[model samples]
Target: MKKKIFLVSTAAALFLVACGINSGISSEQIGLRKASLENENKVVLADINYSAAQPGEASVYDRSYENAPPLIPHSTEDLLPITKDNNSCLSCHDKAIATDVGATPIPPTHYYDFRHNKSMGDVISDTRFNCTQCHVPQSDAKPIVGNTFKADFTNKDLLKKSNLIDVINEGVK
Candidate 1:
């Protein structure tokens, strides 16, 4: 009887310790809660899902046109993507060279003049330098779930990418 009591006590203590360990851990640490995902009290799913993709799970942009956004179609050579330090979108489009490529130069509207600091007076700066901050990949990615889409413009040549409002409405449906 004493042995059984000792064994039972040990099991109960182990169980309590396990529970205590988790209780002491912050919700973020345990992933049950995240301040990062809290957008006005709603848990944002985009920031939470990071999968260790399977081997070869991500193609080398090898998807077909029906399954992909139009691939860059040409080499963005010497281009400085907005993530210049890490981006590749502007290496070819920066006004310095777009004329050579017969492509329009990046617009004046695209630049942010950060002349606030006296030292930076009259200098246009790349604010929010991360290209993804304002421009998203033209991923033409398929919907994760089934989507029945009909083009608003019946002409094949006129089918363009959806704007923000269009994408949001698609999500709602």
Candidate 2:
């Protein structure tokens, strides 16, 4: 029984070594590709070229599809940490003052409390209070990965058939 056990252990050890599993170095040391940002020289901590957007100067980006959340077209440097009582965004984005302030009005859908029986209300719903949750401020930073995504509007055939707004209003039926 002792000889049989020794033989089995020796065979296992031999098999591992034969399969090159005993290599002292990691798989990364054996020609594994490094991250896209990693380089042999010139270590970059962060994107140095990125700058904070100026107030009311941010360029509006086109939406990818119908009902897509519009990107914030201005700086939101001090307008954050939305609380129960305070929301700086509401000063200009609220329906009553948005047109006068030249800021886009918050969508009517934002007033509906979807979680609480989808009831409509006068004020922005609790679920939609934080504007930044769905809307992101545009930046000059380039994406790490190439995006091949194309919107439906780009297709000439679709445009010829009917306007995008008409199709969206008709629903998927």
lDDT score, candidate 1, position 37: 36
5-68 per-residue lDDT for model 1 (tens digits): 9999999999999998878765454454454332436565453332233322332232222222
- Clashes (backbone N, CA, C under 3 Å), per candidate, total 9, 0
Q: What TM-score does prediction 1 earn? A: 0.30
Report the C-alpha lDDT of model 2 over 1-173, residue by residue, as the tens digit: 99999999999999988778666655445442332333445334445342266645555566655456776667777887777789989988888888887676776777766567454656788777887898777666666568998666645444222243334436556
User: Which lDDT values do the candidates have, in the order given?
Assistant: 0.44, 0.66
Return the TM-score for each candidate structure.
0.30, 0.62
Model 1 segments beyond 4 Å from truth? Answer: 1-87, 114-124, 145-173
